[model samples]
Target: MVASLLILAVSGGMLWAVGLNYDGLTGGQAQKVHPASYLCVLLVLWQMLRRGNPVANLVSAAEHRPASCLLAAASIAMAAQIILRGASGTAGAIDTFLQAALVMILLLESDARSLRRLETLVHAVMAANAVLGIVEFATGQRFFPFRLDGATFETDTRSAALQGHPLGNATLTACYVLALIAGGGSLKPLTRLVMIAVQLVALVTFGGRSAIVVTLVLGGAFGLAQLLRAIARGRIPLLAAAGAACALPLVATTVAGLAYGGFFDALLGRFASDGGSANARVAMFDLFSRLPLRDLILGPDPSLVDSLRRITGLEWGIENPIIRVVLYQGALMALLLTTAVTLFLVEVGRRCRAGIAMPMIAFVVLINTFESLGGKTTLLAKFVIVLVALYRPFPETRIARAS
Candidate 1:
């Protein structure tokens, strides 16, 4: 289990070591494929072969149908980009999606105990990273300096967690919070409460406005639903209540210790004005108006896209995968992307309780509004790991509901 989790963490891009710098693999950190990505490919190939070779394994198993369909659909976009626009057409975004898909496939084969262990590993990593985030914010010292190209550019605006992207860290931290609170990882009552506080605080340090807003709204909805369900049942369990009460003081103590150490100055400042993120989003859509209709409908040459970026004075390329698919892969590929994502949702959701699953999906979609998971991200990979770790089969849940 330890070895498996180590592979999983490294492959998922969750490590904190300096060696994981991911240099040379690709110059741009956001578009690079780390050494860990190669590890994922090897592990996936091994898993497929063990299941009776790649082709037969994917096609023959009834349980594999969902993953098979999703992969097939998603591959269309990636394959289309390569076939039509050449190997240089895409940045590393689609590669991230493919790596995440492979992670999901490997996880589906894990037994229940291994899944639980995986969740524990994720929780440990989250907690460690949260503490590191807090320290970085408190001391105004980041372990990993921000790199602009090959040069080290330092910043105090936000804590750069292990993965070295504040926004991505914020997104994953938010997802981790939702997953834990919604029910997944094994946690003692007090530990759970404390981690929630730590993670939420770390979230502020990372200062992702979208993650903060979406998490708050969805979290409130989930809380209300849980309360309503408990009330309708006519009673809260005495043991559960007693345990929560017992854990309250510890949770309070934990909060009191951490609360004053790091302030939300950065978060508050960004909330006032999003550093032109809103303007940038608006400008992205304007690219369509400027593009030739033919290029817009049928993926433009990547070089043409860049020339247009200069023409339009936009600062970045695609931030959202939904938009990226249409602009980079064309309209037909967009349909395939949507179909693939929908299939992935269904597959992941069935392994979790409906209450938890719905909110988690909502969180992913909301976070994606600001950035693409199909880009250089392990959010999808980690999210799927959490889902399976907390796995409660759909039929089992239905049986319980009926009873």
Candidate 2:
């Protein structure tokens, strides 16, 4: 029952998130934001309801075990932001909320009965997301209410719709596709085919080089892993089919590359553009270096956010979440956040032992390659996944009481 509600909350929140503007408020907050985000907050709290101490519940799973220096270092950096800057409190609140949700999931899923329900929820979300994405594409308007502007889904000027941010859309679509794959839920062949078609269309819409790169990297890795497993199992035909399938895409791309100059040119242009150059990041790195040593250890004051805006003519930095946290919060706070998340991921990975964790890691690593993951929404999503993957209640315990 709790898992069902959480799924509804997540679906509702994603719809709202896609619908809302970059500011994250719908209709000035006075007109009323969608109830989805608030619902997500409630779902997160459900983890701790009369459930005994959360920390104590996780104790058997060793969640509070002593963390490594790398982990410690990261959390300290995050803590520094909260203590010194006070800038990230709102975003941090979202992260904490997601963390709570994850804890609940881990606790709830420990039993067989709850695990089945969780699987159902995952598949349902995947189906819903795929349908919404397709409908939005077909209509050429935001699929959900109060849609926001980004690279893909545009609410701004005339040409903006045509040039919708490709990468962001692709990332969102691909994440759902991966979720379906990782969740291990059963689906009919036609439904699976439909999902692939929808995701492919979304991918083309995304048009970000980073998304393309991620697709290639992750696709290659998964293919290799599967092939190795097939070989070990002596599945000769499967190995042959896998090898042939992998070669086909590259071959098709190469053939298409020769026929279209714009395709190759645009691809290369993403790399050559000065504004997108790696040297741009170097400038930010230099700024980090010039700060006082203590700034790296703790963080700048919350007022520094305004200071940073005045200097950069932008609200936030790009390309590195770590750098963003350090600049916005402080070293200590960044460190704390990093440690908590790292530990959470490690714990969940050990418990599930599923390949699902690979794509989650890829999402983070890939985003950091092009843009910072320090945004409140981005961090919140990250923490939510951690919560979902980790939390599973004791079904036996719940059932016994009911019986």
lDDT of each: 0.64, 0.47
**What are the per-residue Cα lDDT tens digits for candidate 2 across 1-403?**
4533443333322444545443343344321222333454455355445466766644533432223223323433444535454353453334333433343344433455655665565545544544554455445555333233323323321111111223334454455455444433455655665565555444543445565566666766775888699889987686657767986897688648743734344345555763434654665665565567786666666565446544754432455766766776667666666666666556444444345564566566655654434653333343334334323323444534766
Clashes of each: 0, 50
Using TM-score, give the best candidate's number: 1
TM-score of each model, in listed order: 0.81, 0.65
10 residues in a row with least lDDT, candidate 2: 156-165
Error of 1 at 134 (Å): 0.8
Tell me the tens digit of each residue's lDDT in model 1 across 80-117: 56666674533244345565566666655666666667
Candidate 2 stretches with Cα past 4 Å from truth are 1-88, 96-110, 134-139, 144-183, 188-194, 224-234, 237-280, 313-316, 370-372, 378-403
